[model samples]
Target: MNEFTMNDLMVLMPYAPIIIVAVTSLLAMIAITIQRSHFVTATISVVGLNVGLFTLIGQITGVIDSGAVVASAEQLFVVDSFAKFNMVVIFICALACCTLAYAYLANLKDNKDELYLLLLLSTTGALLMVSAQHMAAFFMSLELLSIPLYGLLSYTYMRNRSLESGLKYLVLSATASATILMGMAFIYAQVGSLAFKPISLVLGSMFESPLLILGAALMLFGIAFKLSAAPFHMWTPDVYEGAPAPIATYLASVSKVAMMALAVRFLIDSALLALPSVQMLLVVMATLSILAGNLLAVRQTSLKRLLGYSSIAHMGYVLIVIVSIGAAADSISSMYMAIYAFTSIGAFGVVTLMSSPYRQSGEADDLSHYQGLFWRRPIITAVMTIMMLSLAGIPLTAGFITKLFAILAAVQGTNWFLAAMIILGSAIGLFYYLRVMLTLFKRPKQFIEFDVAGQWGIRVGGLMVIGVTVVIIYFGVLPNSLIVWSDMARIW
Candidate 1:
């Protein structure tokens, strides 16, 4: 029998955030059984998430002060600067989502307390994902992150779209997971290892093997599906349209961020990006996603769907920086993803806040729903406008800075094609984004009554809107701080 060592315990310390969330989830479930109260459960969830976030920050600070930390469990988990950076992003997004969910779930007719448990569990999975250094850990975390989403997506089980979305996601995600597992099996059979570093060490020698290449391709396909990149993005719009607003926000921000971090880690740490075939695949996918996403979004009347398509394009842009993995790639990718997360949260936060409590449909997601929004909810309208502008890459907004960073990364890597496609995509994106803005300010053909009556949830949501708006504008004006921070958070 082996005794536990200090290194083993130290390795576990970085996982405090995951541990905290998991415990809180169980406690929340127990509390739900003891007494079912939405406010009480929400309070517990929010407090737990906040505490988890703080723990994550402390771990990050320790890493910064001391050095990178790796778990003693066969080096399968690590808390390097890369992991810390992504964990911080995931925790912040989770916290914001929990805050938004408090209000969003308050008026729902269904049993809502359990949603928080799922949220915490999903976040725990995401935390595990970004820190996963081994393929086995990666797959386990992927399922953990995904399984809860099915419940969260179809939380409003009575609605037809909710049911459809959940079923679609469950089926598609299961297929993707199986594909990934197969790929992992193939790679394991060939390389005889599940850890990233060992596989990387042997990849060069086994580079010519058809099984290895096939495995890599399948894994990339699965990852691309999760990221909703290009042809694999078919499920995105339907899921976004059908899911509750807060859940949609979680999907767009938290889930994507975690997956992006994992994808980057795999590509870089495994040295898989060195292969020309892999590079070409990424480039092709990025190009198609950029062009098709923007083009398809132009005709969207549903704001949720529009944003879904926009996310596809945004991820394509992120992929551009990812493919150009150089000295600046990781920093640029982090900055780009951070800006996207904040702006996306702000965008969906407005949508979540505007969601009518009495509507059976869940959220008012249509273009007509927001017609003359500026005349009614000016603050939400302003926030939405900022987010849209940022998404469009307009100057003096975080989106513009993020786009510039991506373009710079492409230029630095001498990837002229991707740089041009990014510019083209941004230009195309502006039309739809500006169209939404125009609708917000348009004169209503007839006055529609709104429930101007406020609630605690709404007021808190307004504060979140204000907070995200300020961050967007601040970063847009003084981009240096975030840029420096992103640089410090480099993966490799």
Candidate 2:
């Protein structure tokens, strides 16, 4: 076999969409530094994402036409059907986030230009993460994907909660990073290699080694924290409640989807998910997350916090894909994740539009704030209604289809316990979702009027929410296109 070389790395780097995004971020940073123009900066960032997205499609088509999975020198990254599909979703989600951030930040008095820069940087990090094929790359990608979030979470400096969430995420994320590093150390001590495929090949009879399993478990612990799964999900609601609405959207969608992709890649490439110990651990986490997420959201009066808790359960549902083996499981998981991403965007986009940036009393995030919304703002009411229905997995929404996919995967894997949890959790989730819908028509609360309906920022955000809501309904009615696409994509 030919040896890995610097020339190969240099030639291959330009082929990845990550380079386009990274360069765009650099250019945006330069423009922001020269002149603090929020519109210019935001435009630059969005356009770059669009370019990166197109480049990604072009790259994938070229690779497929050539019928090859291209890994850079030293196998640090690989572009397969799975990477292609997930990366496409990441780009799309990031695009939506960019527009949402634009609308949300337009009303801000803070330095809005830098927030877009951080967003571009974070998007670059996520792209790097999804295609990582080596432990070193994975560890580096995790940090790249997380560090900018620390800044974004706290971007609204005037808000105490924003600052608090930023600090909370900083401390917790650092600890998680350390845990991941140590896990990598443990695995390296045994395998003497950090490339995923190599480790699997070298393990052979030693695949059941205590140290290896311990390392895998540690890594999963850190990842579960990122996914906000069950016991490790305590930080999720706090962060969601504290951060600005669009920032919360990024956390719920882009960050969640990227990590899930990496986790799936690690399990599949290392062949570790097949192990009984890992499988049982995953099932337990899945069960707790589903039950805990749905149960906790039941009592939430804060909409953002409720969605945060709800995300935990949705992630648990996504985990069903990880522990199961075969193409069907992978496809179903991707479908669920994509639906979750779009649903989250629509949900949070509505919140961002409804909440006031300069409200002395703070954002209009409470359930009472949305009560009787249908009387004053029928469009927002309809948008939020669809979001709630989708989140609840009601029929005629994309969420219902995702639930079906999860059930099929669970039964296919013979995981009856998890299948039962899926059913129970959705049943429990429906209660709170319907409660929110009821509030929309009851009586408008006299708390504090956000009165943002006339603002330009609100208009931009409102349109996006409506567009996303329409798509959700469309997919709910006809999911065959996405289903066929999912079947076409796979890691190998």
lDDT to native, each model: 0.85, 0.83
What RMSD, rounded to one decimal, does every model reach? 2.4, 3.0
Tens digits of per-residue lDDT, candidate 2, 1-492, equal 144575566456534578888889899989987999988998898899898788777766664232234564358877677877888889988888888787777767778888888888888778878788899889888888899999999888688888899999999988888888888898899888888877667667786899998998888989999999978999999999888888899999889988988888887787777567888889889989999999999999999999999999999998876675443455678788889999999888888887756664567788888888888778778888999999999889999998888888888888887788899999999999999899889977776476446653345566677788988999999988768877745777
Model 2 misplacement above 4 A: 1-14, 61-69, 72-74, 326-328, 446-448, 455-458
Spell out the clash pairs found in candidate 2: none
For candidate 1, lDDT tens digit of each residue in 1-492?
134575565556667777888989998999999999998888898888888778777665654233225444347677777877888888888878888887776667778898899999999899888888799899999999999999999888877788889999999999999999999999889989888877778888977788888888899999999999997999999999999888999999999989988888888877778777888889988999999899999999999999999999999999999887543466678778888999999998888877754466557788887888888677778888999999998888988998998998899889998999999999999999999999999986485543233553357666877799999998888888778778766664
Q: Please, what is the TM-score per model? A: 0.95, 0.94
For model 1, give the 10-residue run with minimal summed lDDT: 64-73
